[model samples]
Target: MTGLAAASLAVSIAVAGAGVPAQAAETRRAPATATAQVFAVDWVSLGIAVAGYLFSGGGGGGGLQAAIAEIKAAIEQSKTEIIAQIDAIAAAEVEACLEAHTIEFLNIDFMDEYTLRAWAQNATSCATQASAFAGAVQSPQAVDKIGFVIGPIFAIVLAARAQAGFINGTDLVLQSQIRAYEAVVTKLTPTDCQLIVTSEGSAFYEKWWRCTAYNGDVGRSSPCFGRNCLPNRAMAETQATLNTSRPVANGALPRLRAALP
Candidate 1:
């Protein structure tokens, strides 16, 4: 998503989902499955952005000195957790490929982040077992302080476009990718995490986290979507979730938005 979109989303719902503004209700409706997933990913990136926002010594209430330790710990802990499943998938794919081929490798090496399984007789070339793994595994993008901070906003904007039908979600492969991301973000974050916006109004989108009043009055908005849906964050979030799918994981669409165009 573009920075402009992210700016719009962040501005909209910097608060909580269930407590989002009422303005969104007038114009924007809930988005489709594909669009909602984009919001999910944007939140992850936003978590990092929230930390960055804290860094400039701004945003949130507690002083930076007081929260710095906790914030860093959260980021560090989250970082370890974020990469585990991806690595597991890559490892399993490599093992399965070797087993199926009945190939015995003497040694494995990396080139441009791709795996090269070498044997005495023949060598295997890897852009990694899958290109999905290549970008993620090869010199995995270090969590840049700036990019990590700004990325969420960028993603949210792109997602807003998708939610608004500016981006197409007809591709089945892309939908699967969305599902997997949904799974990962949910799994890595607190189990009590709540999604303000959802497609089908299933339990999946129910409020689990405490709702705080953002641009709108705290207790006024609906559990699914507030009265206004606040244009920037909540609006975008609600719009993104309007018509989302139940995340299904087949690894078809593993590439993140940055990894894409």
Candidate 2:
């Protein structure tokens, strides 16, 4: 039993035995006079009956002793139950933080799928348990112990990690675009304009004459006569991609070059 509970019970037992003879109290190793106090234990009357029995030499402190012991046991049991309930609540909050935010943040890159999944699961467990003690304090004081929320410290951590991952993905897309442009640039050599500009229908253009190269072809022609075409093949191809909303094929570069001026 807690010290407070034990002290309270002792006071009650003493009160019930107040009427016992001073000699009897002394024989029992109790104080000579009972304090003018009433114990809160409702069963104190039963203890008083036991005190009467004590005076009669039948039973003295046995019944009240039993009652005090029972009270102490009940108090201890109540304490245990309350603590268990709080622990359950704390565990629930930690799980919420893991599921609601931590896992999602780690899922940004599929390349990191296995590694991130493993790391996130482990980190969540560690962070959650670490936050458990915070539950004992007010929520504001123990920010991490609370459930997942966009504005909380946990959410901030998630955002920071996600941004870092996003930067990597951005770099990859940029590098691919740079490589595609470089490939087209390497293939485009300087072409001399033909002696005559003739209108020829190209395969990729409806009015092929408008898009036909400067050098030599006349109406809806497919083959190029020489290295005679637009100045910027790569930029035109990239723009075509922007217009069509997809990657421009390498084979289409020759046709796209014809359209570029």
State which candidate has the highest lDDT. 2
Model 1 clash count equals 22
Predicted candidate 2 versus true structure: per-residue lDDT over 97-181, tens digit per residue: 4444433443434536566545544443444343343333333212211211111222223222232322222222222223332
C-alpha lDDT of all candidate models, in order: 0.28, 0.29
Residues 1-261, model 1: lDDT tens digits: 333222322322222243333232211222332222222333333322323332333433333222223323332333332232223342565434423222222111122222221221121212112323322432222111111112222222222222222223223222333433444223222222234554444434432123222212122123544433432333333322222221111111233333233
Q: Report the lDDT of model 1 for residue 104.
A: 20
Cα lDDT for residue 64, model 2? 33
- Which whole-number lDDT from 0 to 100 does residue 206 have in model 1? 31
TM-score of each: 0.19, 0.16
Q: Could you tell me which 10 consecutive residues in candidate 2 have the lowest summed lDDT?
A: 31-40
Tell me the lDDT of candidate 1. 0.28
Top TM-score model: 1
